[model samples]
Target: MEELMFCYQCEQTIGGKGCTKAGNCGKDAEVAALQDLLVYQLKGIGFLGNEILKQGKNIDKEISKFVQDACFSTLTNVNFDPERFVEYLNKSQKIKENLKTLLGNVPANAPECVNYTIPASKDEMLKDAKKAGIMYDQNLDMNIRSLRETLIYGLKGMAAYAHHAHVLGFYDNDVDNFFYKAFASTIDNKLSVDDLFNLIMEFGKVNLKCMELLDKANTQTYGNPVPTPVLITKKKGPFIIVSGHDLKDLHELLIQTEGKGINIYTHGEMLPAHGYPELKRFKHLIGNYGGAWQNQQNEFDNIPGCILMTTNCLQKPRDSYKDRIFTTSIVGWPDVQHIREIDGKKDFTPIINKALELGGFTEDEPEKTILVGFGHNTVLSLADKILDAVKKGQIRHFFLIGGCDGARPGRNYYTEIAQKAPKDTIILTLACGKYRFNKLDFGSIGEFPRLLDVGQCNDSYSAIKIAQGLADALGCGINDLPLSLILSWYEQKAVCILLTLLSLGIKNIYLGPTLPAFISPDVLQVLIDKFNIKPISTADAELKTILG
Candidate 1:
């Protein structure tokens, strides 16, 4: 039998033993092999890009953008088309060749990764990719392999956020440069485990910077997100459902669909779009339609309008509504209509016309509201009140339950944690993970609501800011405060966030559904010993332990 693809980059990897046949996220062996080949070529690009930077020369701006997009394409559920990977591989080679001409004659025996080449045909590429997987690293130390994989995964997450910010016209030189450095280091066999571990920590610092850049881009482009109650039910009219995390796409869609008699509803991470002042100003930008990305097929089944996917977390559309589903940016599927940007503007008329033809729902559904937009600014505005509540013993503890939501069976722990928390405890959530309990009422503690939605996973920077602010206001270290991080991770983005937390020396984080399969036993022990990170147990049991 032919060797199957090996992918263990996500939380839902098959049996926690790597996906030998196909990925759980609908990626087949061919796509997975292409992704691995893409990463290998990206290492070469990073090497050349970094060398050019060291010589005080500026690489093409498009090189940075290409690096960001290529890394993002390799992320879980982002791109599955082998043809796209072939295109990326060809582009990477051209970029590397251009950089090489600029750098005159160099050492003849330079690193092999710096001069990596793509095969002439797709068949040759696949044959070569069979030997170029994550396990291809010939390092004898398992710990070294673990740290290297961790760095690669973290960089992939950073690339996604950076790409979003880049599209919104935000660029950070340090953040972009670090990507090249991280990618190049992954192929450097001379680096010791300790050296690689320090680089891994640096990946966390840069990821935090990337997330901060995205936060700035998001807030500046679309004004700061404010506290707003979003309607959860449908209105009787033509409507379009926008999913994924790209605010710019949603912003464009809202503008194009306005006054066209079409209502726009957000789904998954896009739910937080309703709180931005610029986005919410459009009257037709109605409300959110579904829970999280995991429920897209069921929620969208036989839906009456068009659906636009803007980023990752997109599942294969069911045939029942596949024709109405449209994808943009790096998202693609076999037969769905993909809308691309012409000049600088994206024509959403296709999605709009589809919505108009479908005629949406026959009658207005009953009103249901869920509060969102409690970002760092909004939360800090209430700092005095929150601090006073804590001083007065009204708000006992703060529980931050956030990260990507998944379809795994054990994910209900998040919902149960929200349900069982004491009335005085504040539960702050972000990303689609909050969907598990965002609709459930937790009542208010003093003047502050017991549950606060802090935008998307990118707004994790907001959560970190809130924690630091609270720590400063109380004259204590963040770890010494009455705050606990209970995160449910599902993909590479979550890996970056976890590294950010660990980099800050934050301890006692509760993570589930299970620890990453990528972390070797020794590496896991190191994390446990240094940070006290623990796997989640039953909600009641974990709550008792945390409260005590």
Candidate 2:
């Protein structure tokens, strides 16, 4: 049989041997091949775009948006439709072709990526994609290949954030230029391993900027997140469930559904929407209904309302609820009704009508509330009290257990850690990983809550700021503080965040549920030796080791 597509970009690849026949995330060979082709064409566009920038010429804003969308579309589980990938690939080729004309002749020594041509048909594209799989670099030096792949994955995460921020009317020329530079560098075979390693670090720095841009966009548009309690139960009424990371979509949905008797509930990463003042003002905006993205297959299986996915971490819909699933932005699944904007407005009437038809729960389900929006500003506001508690032995340590959540069995370790943490310890959590234990009551340590939610994955910026504030206030290095970072990673976003941490010279981080499959043994040793990053063992043992 012909060799199948290979993809191991996420934490869970089949047996760590790469997904040869089908992705563990429900992506088949066809979608995988098309995604690979899309990435290749993106690189071609990046090469041309970068060359234009080097000449001090401004690249078109639309081209930058195209690159960002294409990169985001290739993220795990975001888009499984082959046709969507084909469309992105063709658009990328058109951008590159247009740039070539405007920028004049190319150098004879240019890399093959700069001269690459898009296949004219879907059949031809699939045939060409076979040669573009990530495994094509397998024969290269192991260390060099590892660094290159790391940089590429980091760029993917950065692109996702940049795209989100761009949609919200925020744009940074430095961030956009770095995307082109990083993409162009990936195809340059002449770069030494050390060069690629430096590029990886540089990408980390730019990723920090990207995250900061997103943080500003979110805060300025929605107001600084304040600590708010979000209900985990559904109300009795027509309701719509909004999932993913797009606050803009949630805001719009809340506006359109207001006073229409259709309640709005947050799901997955959208849970934090309740903390923003602009969003919480909507009376019909109810609370969250589900946990992390991985739990959606079961949580959304028979939901009584329409669900709208606005970004990444979306799984293939089951037949039971597929009819009620609506996708927007770069997210796409075959047969699902996709909502798009025309004249700068999105008509959510179909989703709203579906919710009214379902008639929601018979009565309000009584449930516990989870606290969210303990971002840096909110956390630091209580810093003086927290410091007093720590000095008085009321608070012993701070554990930052945050990152992406996945379906692997070991993910239970996060829940176990949260449960097993002593009462004297305060937990700082972020991203979707908090869902594992956020619903539980950890009680309080003096005036400070035991658990603090710091927004989404990008809010790692806030977590870092909080840590630095503590370090500065105490007049000690960050390493000397009584803090432990036990993070769980499953996607490129997590990878970029980890790189940012390491780039800041932070050490002794505990990473789990498993290490990335792309890290070679030698590369892993470099990380282990330099940063003291360790894979998590049993929660009890790990906790003892950390506290001791």
Candidate 3:
């Protein structure tokens, strides 16, 4: 058999077997190598950026854009197109060159970016690529390697979000500078796990600023989100389902198709659309399409409508629905229609026409409703009711059982934790992992439902807001409150969200579904010693630990 699929990113990747050739999710050798190269280049630039910052020089917007572009490009399921990968590499290299010249110094010409098929004489390329990838300690023990991987992966996720925020005109110099420092430090063999772990926490801290920028971008641009229910039934005409995570793209589409016959439905992480005010205001903006990210292939197969992916979490499309897919921004799949950015605004008229031509479901299907619209504003508005419930002994605890999910059987642990959580404890979740139990009716403690679905993966910002709000209401610090965070991570976004939590100095977080492959042992120990990070064990055991 030809070796085309191999990957080590998420758990349950091909029988938990290391993907030695190609990723099962359509990632090939070229994409993998380029992603690694982009990461390494970011590290090199990041290190250099830190030096500039040390000398009291702030990297200019052009330089920062390159760093952000590198991070955003490497996010899982984002830039899978080879051509685009090359484009990003050239742009990144130019930024590095420009930055070096701007600072009156010069670094060597970067090696060629990684390509799909290895060249005949790849010894130098392979060596450079591997070195750039920043392997930690061929001489170190296993644990340090794992911990370093975890922290690095988390930063990758943070970088993606930070990049998005940066694009929206929000830039934090401290955060930007740290990006360089962290990437540069990875290349240094003298660094200890303690140093890396501290960096991990720093990643979390900077991520908060990044997330805050996004939260502002979304809320200010879209108005504070309110509770709005979404319907599962497709209206009786042609429509489109837009997946991935770009709110600006969604808003533009809503504007582009304002009076058209096409309707818009959200899918995967995009399900939280029903909660945003500006998006919900669109008359044609209908409800959600499928369940979570994992079900996209089955859900979209043979469906008559078009699918527009604005960001990551795209699986390889089946032939049945291949013709129906369109991608914009960083999300790409081979041979799919890509909506390009024009004059800083994406014109999606083509997408709308395609959806109309495809037509929709054969009939007005039976409508099913899924509850949503429980964003931070909605939760905070009910603070009095929640506080009253607690006073009346109607509520006992709060559990933020949220994060990305994977195919690993161990992921069932999240479901168990949510299922076994005290009946009086409220479960606040975001990202695709909520699919494990989002449909469960745990009954409300007073008027508050047992589970609150806060928008998409990026909406982890909402959960943090709620946690801080509750802490303020009780006149105590966030950690002192009776709130527990049980996170299950699968991808880089999860890594960033975890970092934001750590940056806040939030401790005793329980994380699982297998610690990251990138974290080194020494890093893990530092996390354990400093912040009491624990792996997810049995739900019963973990629940007891959280409660006690």
Candidate 4:
């Protein structure tokens, strides 16, 4: 078979190499090519945006947002509509032209990406896309190519974080500006490996700030998440299952569905929405319905309620429920209904009507509950108690086992690690990755549950804070504390968070189910040598080593 596209940014890419025919996430050749073209154009915009900045000019916030949303849409599983990528390709061209004009004296010798004419039609764009992908540079140094792809993937993740914060009215100029600088650097032929490595390290600190901004945006608007128990059971009557990471979408849905005989339950990352006081206040905002994104196919199969995906982590829908599943924000599928905002607001009346038409579970499922809302605020407030436990020898260690979850084999290493850890150890987790063992009965150690879920993946800030707070309280470096990190990554957001951790000099992280294929052997050795990062082994073996 002829090769169509190449992508290896996610953990589950084919054979731990690159996906060549179609994305493992269900995107086809045409859509894949268009996304490649969109990214190629984004780099061009970044190139010109940086040029404008060099002359002490301010690019409009809208341009920054365009760059942000464009990068985010190209992320794994975010958007698969060929037409949408065509739109993005065209829009990016217009933006690049506008930036070039703003810069005034554009060099005729600028990179081909910066000076190329964009094809107008979808057919033309797809043709161009085939030649615009990362693999096009057959002559580039392998290690350099590795670093460049790493940098771009990390930027994609950071853009996702920034976009989330932006939705909640939070803006950080440094974060936005860094996007231009970083994306522009990906096209630089003169940067050495060390230079790229150093720039990538700086991104860690920047992404930390980005996550902090998102934390503030969420807490200030929704109030601090408190320890709240969310049902894992279904309720009778009409209900809507909200998936992905966008709370504002869920909040708006909650408002629109109230008093309409509909229940709103969270699925996947939206499970954390139940912990927010402002959002949970809506009584119709019932609880969570599913485990993680990977399970949505069977989980939603023939389920009575409609599904609403607000962001990424959307698998190709099954024929049974595809019509009932609606997308909003940047998430897309070929034929699924998409809810776009009208003048900065979305109307969920169609979604509401879908729920009414489908009707929900025929009978109330058996009641089961899991706890959430363990953000930094909640965890920090209990630091004194945690410190007391540690001092008294009641707690032996801390293991942070979380990240993006996927359907690939071998992820159960997380569940085994969580289950086999010493009885005296405390487990801290965040992200949908927690679903691997979240339902297990790991009883508490005095006042704290053995498992502390620190909200969504973005709330990784909370875990960092908790670690830092413990370090300060104990008067030692974060690495000096008795903590180990076991992470399972699936997408770009995980990549950015990993960069943030490595930048902070956090070490000895156990990463699996497989190392990213983009990291060349040379670069992987550098990371291992510098930080002592290790690929995960069997769960029991890793546990014995970690606890030993």
Which candidate number would show the highest lDDT if scored against the true structure?
Answer: 4
RMSD to true structure for each model, in Å = 1.3, 1.3, 3.7, 0.9
lDDT of 2 by residue, 1-548 (tens): 75688888998899975888999998889999988888887777778888898889998787888888899888887888888888888888888889898678887887776678887899998888877788776677877767877888888888889988998999999899988888888788889877987778788888888888998999999898998988888789878889989999899998888889988889888888888899998888888888899989899888888999998888889999999999998899988999988987999999999989988888978777888999888888888888888899898999999999998888889999999999999999999888888888899866678998888886788998899999988889889899999999999989999998888889999998988988988889988998999999989998889887
Q: What is the TM-score of each candidate against the true structure?
A: 0.98, 0.98, 0.90, 0.99
* Residue-by-residue lDDT tens digits, candidate 4, 1-548: 76888999898899999999988999888888888888888778888988889999999998899899999998998999887777778888889889988999887767888987787688887777766887887899999989989999999998888999999989999999998898889898989999999999999999999999999999999999999998888888998999989988988888788799998888898888888999989999888888889999999998887999999889989999987999999999988999999999999888889889998888888899998889888898998999999999999999999998999888888999899998899999999789999989899999899999897787888999989999999999999999999999999999999999999999999998899999999999999999999999998888889777
CA lDDT of each prediction against the hidden true structure: 0.88, 0.87, 0.75, 0.90
Which candidate would rank higher by TM-score, 2 or 3?
Answer: 2
Supply candidate 3's per-residue lDDT for 311.
84
The candidate, 1 or 4, that scores higher on lDDT is 4
Which is the winner by lDDT between candidate 2 and candidate 4?
Answer: 4
Assess candidate 1 and give its TM-score to the true structure: 0.98
TM-score of candidate 3 against the unseen true structure: 0.90
Off by over 4 Å in 4: none
Model 3 deviation from the true structure expressed as Cα RMSD, one decimal place:
3.7
lDDT of 1 at 432: 79
Give the per-residue lDDT of model 3 (tens digit) for 1-548.
74432346665456554565776666887777667766766766765676677778767876776777667767677777876766666676666666666556534542232112222333433444554443323575555455555656666676667666665677777766777777766656567766766767777777787788778877777788776667876678888898888877888888888888788898887888778877888988887887777778889999888999988888888999888899987778778889998778787877788788887866777877768878888899999889888878788888888888666678888888889988878888888888888777788776777988887778888899988999999899999988888888877888778777877888999988787655555666766887899888899998887777
Candidate 4: residue 42 lDDT (0-100): 79
Q: How many backbone clashes does candidate 1 have?
A: 0
